[model samples]
Target: MEIILEKTTKPFFKKHAGSQALAKERIGAILEREQATGLTKVKLALRQPVAGRPCFELRCNLAKLGSVRVAFILDGQVARI
Candidate 1:
């Protein structure tokens, strides 16, 4: 089975410098753990919002890491879903 992980960047981070890079690193760490658990990095994206404000949503698939499904969002440096 495959699982998808999604993370949304908050409004504040969009205005802060280096937030995108930080988000990438933070998300990378999560992906690394998934890889260690036998999952493959299938797909990823940094989404743009349609209205209100702009945000990023990263989507990844974990087909090799059992049947567990996980999704999360990032608020600044915090991870939530």
Candidate 2:
């Protein structure tokens, strides 16, 4: 699976110093769990559709930044964030 961070999301990383790394870690864990089990069996994230498009939200909490919601649409083997 490939993860593509949308262009609009770049600013968030720029504004928050460590958010990008944390997000990556969370995403990696999600993928690992999903691979070991399955998307349906993977927990720790929320599955919510946006504009009728299936989307998943991964929440990351940083000591300095609080919580950030990383929402991505899973299309086949690609994940658009």
TM-score of every prediction relative to native: 0.29, 0.54
Clashing pairs in 2: none
Provide the overall lDDT of each model, using Cα atoms, as 2-decimal numbers.
Answer: 0.41, 0.65
lDDT of 1 by residue, 27-81 (tens): 5666556446644443332355323333333353323322322344333434433
Worst 10 residues of 2 by lDDT: 39-48
Q: After superposing candidate 2, which stretches have Cα over 4 Å from the reference?
A: 18-22, 40-53, 61-66
For candidate 2, write residues 1-81 as lDDT tens digits.
677788978898898866676776666566556655666542334455655667666554555677667667766666777
